[model samples]
Target: MKTIISTKYIKNTVLAAAALFAVSATAQDADDTSSPFSLSGSIDTYFRTALTTSDADGTYAPEGASTSFANQTGFALGMANLIGTYEAGDTGVVVDLVFGPRGTEATFENDVLNGIINQAYAYWNVSDKTTLTVGRFNTFLGYEVIAPAANFNYSVSYLFSNGPFSHLGVKADFELSDDVSLMLGVMNPWDTNDISLTGEYSLGAQLGLYDQFFNFYYDSGRNGGLGFEVDYTGGFDLSDSFFLGINAAYNTNSETETGFYGAALYPQITASEDFAIGLRGEYFAYTADGFDDVPVIGLTLTGSYSKENLIIKPEIRLDSWGNDFEPFTDNDLAPSSSLATFAIAAIYSFD
Candidate 1:
């Protein structure tokens, strides 16, 4: 059978894939290190294969990578993440750098004259309730992050893949109470490290209560810019050995009326001291003005084993789409709505 993929999906894929990928505050900081002036980093490598897809002729555009990172075929290098932080009294600075396939993709926009940079910012704790930050930093938008060790599943989710990876702006973080917090900032658009070529600025805000966050981003609509995004992320511990994570986001551009939305659940069980298992079940969809909604469901199962600072993850993922969207070719070389993949990754961190 033959099927014509819609232009909307293509546009959405390109747009989402270009993101360095964004994140949230209540989430663990990918670059945070113990103590001050500590040099820490991680190295990751993986072996991935398409379970039920054939890519001999390279006809499938995304092949088996529908999300982000860990999509490269065969044995691949994820990236080298190096972070340096210095905190003295109330002031601190962080220089986070990355290099490799995953790093390149994460810093797609900042590769101009400065190679690859994951985040570079200076922060100061003001008073007991407020803090100020400036320079480029990872976005406070999604559950997943740029660092491999920070995620339960090596393969990123559609929600994280489509959001802004990092931002070049200034922000203020306020601790309202023992359990409440708020953060607000303005920046030169998404993924831009230098000046905003469009001369347009974007706004970001996050409100945290009892470890749950409500995030928002906004910009004027024109020439395919970001109009707004609303996101919610949180987690609950059902028991001592089991936890559930929830994330949902919606984004729309008023000018083009094009965007995406998604929700995902991460349920994990710590089976032993050095082993854990998790599942990421997600539903993601794209919306456009003149096209039917194209929705996809992704399920990823991952097993994690750790010894000291080294971790190994084995993952299996499957994705199926509706609205006649066949992004993969089956083993029989036929257009198919579903794709399966398997991968194992080795990650080591040092300080």
Candidate 2:
């Protein structure tokens, strides 16, 4: 798809942001009391292919799959991310930019270079326990993140695919106690990072709890009267080298009476400092008033190898449907009830 914004505008924005970032870094270096500004990010690329013979389009995944990072069977650029962070006293800011296929798809629904920015936000510490943040920021809903370096699996879950990616507005976070915290915010309508087409806003909140072995996060939000979504994420350390994580989400749109609900489980084992293996199992269903629910289950096995600043992830995924509600393409030139895919990605990150 064509970009909504012109190339000249994007170029101008990039130049302006670069100048601002340079100024901030220099000022921070000159100020004894200010925290240092940091530049860090990652670049990722991958080769993905469908293992099944049924895919005629060379894309084996189901329609509307969230992690459609490598739809075609070939090598693809995942993303190149550039993040700048600066903090001084009680004020801080984060500027994140990205390019490539995954970045464009995740942040702009496949619109090419509409704007290469992922997030630009600033925060102020109102008190020792409270902070107020404004501008565009990643959503608090999912356990997985947009950054490939942060995820155990290369592909994203259905739950993450359907939830909000970022919010444009203001929010306040509070540390309620040593193990509990809260966040509340008002954001532009769902999925519109730059503007609210509806001219309406959404309400967002999160409750979190954590200790040595367990962490939990719960969040819910609504876009005016349209609909609401809730998500929960939890993680527990099963052992020094083993961990378990869970995620569940539900969303409903009042106008269309359509929505989806799903959950996923992650189990990971770290064999050493440089190697780890993980599994993702998920079940998802789409629902409406009179229609029969279409359900799908997905399983993915992934292994990651780390060396210095580079990490390599190799993954295999299989998806199946209970009924004949087939949406996957197979080489058979007919709708298929299942699909299998394999991918390997390399992510290089530095600061």
lDDT of 2: 0.71
178-293 per-residue lDDT for model 1 (tens digits): 88888888987666666777878889888888878888999752355658899988777777788788899998887878889989998888888888889999999989989998
Candidate 2 lDDT score at position 233: 74
Highest lDDT against the true fold, candidate: 1
lDDT of each: 0.76, 0.71
Candidate 1, residue 211: Cα displacement in angstroms equals 0.6
Worst 10 residues of 1 by lDDT: 2-11
Residues forming the 10-long window of minimal summed lDDT in candidate 2: 2-11
